[model samples]
Every structure is written in C-alpha cells, then in structure tokens.
Target: MINTKKIWYLLAAMAVILITTVALMSNKKEVEKTPKNPYQAIDGAKTNSYEPVGESLELTTDDNVIGNKKAELIVFVYEDYSSPYSAVLAETLSRINSELDNKLTIAIRPFVTAGNNISREGALTLMCAQDEGKFSEMRNVILAAAKEGSLQEGGFNVYANQLGIDETAFNNCLTNEEKSLKLEAIMAEADKNLVIGAPTIFIANEMIIGARPYSDFVDSNGDAVEGLKAVVDRQLSAVGTKK
Candidate 1:
C-alpha cells in the first residue's frame, strides 16, 4: 500500500528473468539432444574412425598379394585405382607392414568406382604387372599418378615401358579377355561383400571403409578403441593366444 508501483515493477522484472532462464534451459536441452556425426574425422588428420563389419574376406591364390604370404595376419583391401583415398591407404599399409615387421599379408583387389577407362585400365595393368613380378612397381606408379591428378586411361603403356614390364606382353594382357573375366569376378566378389566404396579394408574379419593412419588404429582413452591398428592388434593378440 505504501509503495505499490515499486512492488509491481520488481515483480515484472523477476518475471522477465524467470522467462529468460526457462528459455535458455530449453535451448540447452535441445542442444544436448542433437546427435553427432559418427564418421566425423579430425580436420587435416590422416587417421579415421572405423566401423566393424563382422565378416571375413577369403583370400585366394589369384588375388594380387603384397607382403609375405606366411604372415600371421591377412588383410584384404578393395581399392579403386583412380581414388586418392586408395593411394593414401597404399602408403598407410606399407608403413604398417614395415612397423609390424612384415607380419601381414596384404591382398589387393580392384573395385572400379571411377567408372572410367582409367580405373579399369589401371586394374588390368596391375594384373599384368603381377604376372611380370612388377605388381608393386606398377601399383606405385599408378598411385603416384592418381595422387598427382595425372592418371590417363590411354597412358598405361608408358608406365609399362618405364617399369620394364615388356610392352607387348603388358599390352596383350591389358586387352586379354581373361583379364576382363578376372576383373569381373573380383567386382562380383566385392559386391557380394557389400563393399560400397574404395579403400575398404578387411582385417580379422572386420571391415574398415576408408584410408586410416596407424595412429588412428588405437584410442587415446585406452578403453574405447577404433582404428586399423587397434583391430589388427586385437587379432594378433588373439592369434598369439591361440598359438
């Protein structure tokens, strides 16, 4: 009664503060409820988070293999020649093989996602190189070219000549019906395994779908683990235990 106007003013101010607080709380809840991107990778980082595919890739004698066949672990990689990610993976796997003391067998199969002659030609060229014992060399040349954006569909013969792959034999192999059949069979096998993209890797019956660095293979927390190396370690440990 003595100061009714002042009391009303104070009440109105308190109401405004309460409304603001409630709105802020509601917004915070909304933010907390939002989902995160599962495949979100760190910017500029070479490592990637992996999803587990609970299936094994059967290795065959016809598969283009690198590293020692007697290795305890076999890793199958399905890659596209025209994909930069596959190039990254080739480097990563090479490093991993070195770090692991050549304890891995890396089998490579081509999955032509680029849908062009360059990719198909590259794949066929690799098969030809394999016959000539120059698979690794030709693969390196192709990877380098792909990385540099200089890979040409019609330029495979130049690479063959540079690598001393017997130009005639390489050209004949490239145009061979048998090579085409083998590639088709490989593509069908990849499709059966649900390979959706390039650089898909299979280790210890788990599928990793992109190029990942060795560091990303393990988790920092020591409990939550996801990466190429992490899965490989687990498989190695299990194999050791079984032995």
Candidate 2:
C-alpha cells in the first residue's frame, strides 16, 4: 500500500513538469510568430533633407541635357533606373511632351534605389549616350526594356546598340573615373533633396511624391492648363516671399 502511494505522487509530479514544459514552448512559438510593422522596418533608410542654395547645377553630355534652367515651366524628376515606377513616369513625361507641343522643359536626376542594380556603369552608359546626342533615344530604349522586364545580363549593351549608340564609346565611359564622379555627385545632390523613393516629381515648386495617374495632371477641360497655372502661381508666390 505504501509503494502504491509513492508511485501515485511521482506520476503527478512528472505530469506537472510535462505540462509546464509544453506551456513554455507554446508561449515561445507565439512570441516568435508576432508580425513586424512594415513602416518601422525601413527606418534605417530615410533620406536627409537638403536644399540647393544658389544657382541650379546642370549636367551636360553630348547626348543628354539635365539641369536647373529658366523656362516657362520646370519639371524636376528624381528617378532610379531599376525602379518600375520611375520607368512609368518616364513614359508619362514622353507622352506629355508629345501632347503639349514641347511646352515643358524636364530635368532628370538619378537616385539609386536597388542595390547595385543601377550602378556606376549604368550611369556612365547614360552619360555617354547623352554625349552622342542619343540620350533621349537611349533612355526610351532602356525604359521600354525595363517595362518589358528585360534588363538582365548584358541587356543594357544590347539596348545601347539598338539605339545606335557606339558600343565601344559607351563601354569606355562606363569605366571612366571622371564620369563615375559626376554620377556620384548627381546621386549626392538627389540625396540632399530628400529624395526617398524613385519617381518623385516636382513641378515648379510643388512636389508630387509617387507614380500617380496621368489624369492627375488634367483639368476639367481635359487639358493640363490648370495644372500648369497652379505651378506658375506657386513659383510666383515663392519669388514674392523671397523678396
């Protein structure tokens, strides 16, 4: 009778230990399965605000012209070559230019987003094309290829050839240190402007921060005149305040 009692007590203790162990493991798994906040995940990559204080800088190549210039209207675009949103914005700008009869002057600056996707080589290739006066054509080809999802290995070279850019010159430019520095400077300037994402558009002084619909630019009359007027008014207001 005493031996039976001892066995019963031992079994109860063993059962309690097992239950406690299982509960701890279950609680651990629940802790591990908790979801993370998406916005908090990107906290390390935020851009710092920078204002260009003097005369606007310009980058000129034989094929492309980019910079701060006085015009009836100035559209500043911050783009990343590997970003789909940027590609769409490029297409929209092309369409707008065609429909508006060249009423807008556009300035494009490169902002690197994808890790080593739009590299120094890519930027130099663009600059070389600009030197050859084939910047727009080359840009269109690249954007179209990106839209088609074809920018794999050696694809940029193929597109350059398609746009009639001299492949040898492009290759040389891609490896040139001076050209690399220029691209780095452009990227730094983009960083200074607090460009946090690809396809950030600035019309006059107003900023539109994403790949929004083209219709966003149209007014009630199905024309972009109102949009242009808004930009003009903002610019005038800025000038008045400066004085």
Candidate 3:
C-alpha cells in the first residue's frame, strides 16, 4: 500500500528544506566576509565606535617604533609595504613624527596580506633590519625600493650593506622560518581586529582608511576636508588637557 501522493509531498518538503538550508549558509558566509565596521563611501577619517583593542593593539618590545615609545599619543599603523597608498601614508606619518617631535609615537605593524611576493619580502626585510636595530633606516629604504619597483630585482643585500646591517645576518634572517611565522601571526592579529585592507590606521579609538595628506589634517577655509592631522591634533590636545 504505497502512498504515491505522500511520497511526492515528502520529496517536495525535503527539497524545500535543502534549498532553505543552502540559502542560510550562503547568507552566513556573506555576513562573515563583510568587515566588522563596513567602510563608508565618504572620504577622510572614519570614527571607530568600538572599544580600544587593548592588549591586541598594544606595542610590543619588538615593534618598529619612531618617536617616544612611551608617548601618550601612539599612532598604530598596519601597512603593506608594496602598496603605493601605504607608501604615501608612510611619508605622511614620517612628516607628522618630525613635525610633532616627541608628542607622539608611530608604531609600525607590518603585514603581508597585499597578495604579492614583494609585500612579503619587504616585511621580511623590515623585520630582519629590525633584528639589527636598523628598522627605521630599513623601513625608509624598503618603502622607497617598493615604490621604485627595485625590491623585485632583489636589492635588499645592497640596501643592507648600504645601511650597515650585517649582510650575513640579514640574509640569514630573511631565510629564517621563524620570521615567516611571525609575519603570519601579525596578519592573524590584524584579521582579528577586523582590518579589511592595507594602510589601516588606529589613532586612539578612531580607525582611518586610505592615504591622507598633511593638509587633510586640517580644514581649509576655501575647501572642506577632514584629515589625520586634525585627528592627531585633537588627540594631542585632549591628552594635554588631561595633563
């Protein structure tokens, strides 16, 4: 006594269930792919509404830092060396460091998610130079090399020699497996922080995306633009007021 209509209805219900399950899974994946704080179409500074990253954003003893390490205003920079926009941001940060003097610290957290060999290699170069206490010098040289497309030609050795880093040590550090693991850890840390792209900056609780110029730091009388400099100035002023 096979119930043909009942079997047909059962199959139809199963098919509907399967389709719904698949759709739910697809939606979940899309949601996961979306950044925690989705980027807005507007330019300039994007305020981060989340609490401070706490220990995750804190600088370690191994960090490549410029300016006073203990400065109240520490600008955390997560950048890929191969990115032109990151290079521009690097220049802007350096200028800010010089202009602000010891008012702030720039902590560079290098990552290689740029999807290129040059980015990975550049990070390794910076880390290797860091081992020799030459990170600041190597950072400038490697960024310039990345911008000029010279890193692809393997100019690290020449740069190392020029910068007075021990050539043998630098080469050994470059080939070390531990350095690669360290970089992977750095990338994972960035992912955990919801970093969606290179050159993501964390100034206080604010997260700024893309490259910003010094002028963008302040509003112009003729033109309107919000910039990093403005943000930094505000943070600095706040800390000064607190003190």
Candidate 4:
C-alpha cells in the first residue's frame, strides 16, 4: 500500500539526473584544462628549432646568390645553420649545384625558431661578413664550428679576423634593430611561401621538402637528382632558346 510503482519511477528519475550531472561535470573539467606545451608562434612550430643554410647568407647585399643569377634555374632554401638535416640538405644541394656546374642560382634566407640566441647572432655576423665581402669564408668556418659546437662562442669574431673583416665595425653593427626586422621579413616570406619546416627548397613550381639522400631516398618526383636535373636542363634549354 506504499505505492511501489511511484517509488520506482521516482528512483529512476533520480538516477538519470545523477548520470547527466556527472557527464556535464566531466566535460566542464576537460574544457577548462590547458595543454602542457603552451607555446604560441605564428606557424605554431616548436621553439628551439635550428638548421643550416645559404648558398651562404650575404647580409651586405640584398642580392645573395649562390650561382649564375641570369641562369634559368633558381633554388631557394629556408634553413637554420644549426640543423643537422639542414646541413644534409645543404650538402645535397651544393653537390647538385656543382654537378650542374653552378647553373642554379641558390638563395638562402633566415627562418628562425624562438629561443635560439646563436642563430640570431650568427645571422648578424653573416650580415657583417657580407658587408666585408667575406660571406663565403666566414659562413663556412662559422657553420663548421657551429655544426661541431656553438655559434655564440665568440668564434665568429675569430673567423672575421681571419677573413680580414673590420673587427670594430662588425662588432658595433651586431646590435642593430634593423637586423631583427630583416629576420622577421625572412620568416614572413617563408610563411607566405608555405614553408612550415626547415630545409624547404623550390625549383620552378616544384617543391622539395627536407633532405634527399642520393641513393636510398625517393619522393613523388621519381629520382631526386635525375628528375631535378631533367627539370633544370629543360628550363636551361628553354632559357637559352629565348635568349
């Protein structure tokens, strides 16, 4: 006579309410949580990223070139001097350039990640070297040293001295604010060109990402060098014909 059916109905309604409340609380907890890696970047790439670059970066002239400027083929790369893969891709590109007899005009530009003091300083030194017309020597020496150890270890100055760069002038120019603007411009350019990673290369409309091993590597374009060389040769032929 205690109305058993009504009691069951009431208990069932209470159970449903409790389940829904638990679910809502769980979802709310999830919404308020933050990620452990809260880095905010333009491209959202991780900080501490570094790599190698340049046909060598020439800071003195806006026109930094690695090969024939008037040539039909041009290779553009965005690299960091401290990245091993950048070094590898750079070596590959250098080999390809040499094999092609410097027909390609290669341009190296900065695309720095945050928290890299050496990269920023190295870039500054490279610009000074460009001013002194010693970009090649300083870049090679500093990069070699950077590959082995650090670029902010005061070695760039030694290389600059060895290469006969005006020590006082080079040192004085290191703190220029314009260099930061230039660095930002390079990064923006890379972003515009859809460069999301280090060691990105462009040949005509074709895009090459990362390093290409001579023997064991392959991509969508058949053989790396052979296919690339074919493209270069065709472009060279076309340029020669036009001329």
**The best candidate in terms of lDDT:** 1
lDDT of every predicted structure (CA atoms): 0.79, 0.62, 0.77, 0.64
How far out, in Å, is residue 148 in model 2? 1.3
Better of 2 and 4 by lDDT: 4
* RMSD each, Å: 8.6, 9.0, 6.1, 8.6
Candidate 4 lDDT, 1-243, residue by residue in tens: 889999999999999999999999999899789445322221211222123222333323464677777666666777766566676666676776788888888877655656776666777787777777877677677667656665554556777788887788878867778766777777766676567667676664445566545334344566324333454455567667877
Q: Report the CA-based lDDT of candidate 1 relative to the real structure.
A: 0.79
TM-score of 2: 0.61
Location of the lowest summed lDDT over 10 successive residues in candidate 1: 40-49
Candidate 4's TM-score: 0.66
Candidate 2 has an lDDT of 0.62
List of clashing residue pairs for candidate 3: 216-227, 217-230
TM-score of each: 0.72, 0.61, 0.74, 0.66
lDDT of 3: 0.77
Off by over 4 Å in 1: 1-55, 217-225
Q: Give the higher-TM-score candidate: 1 or 4.
A: 1
List model 3 lDDT by residue over 42-159, tens digit each: 3333432233343447887757788888899888888888877788888887777788876778889986765677788888988898888888888888777666766663567888
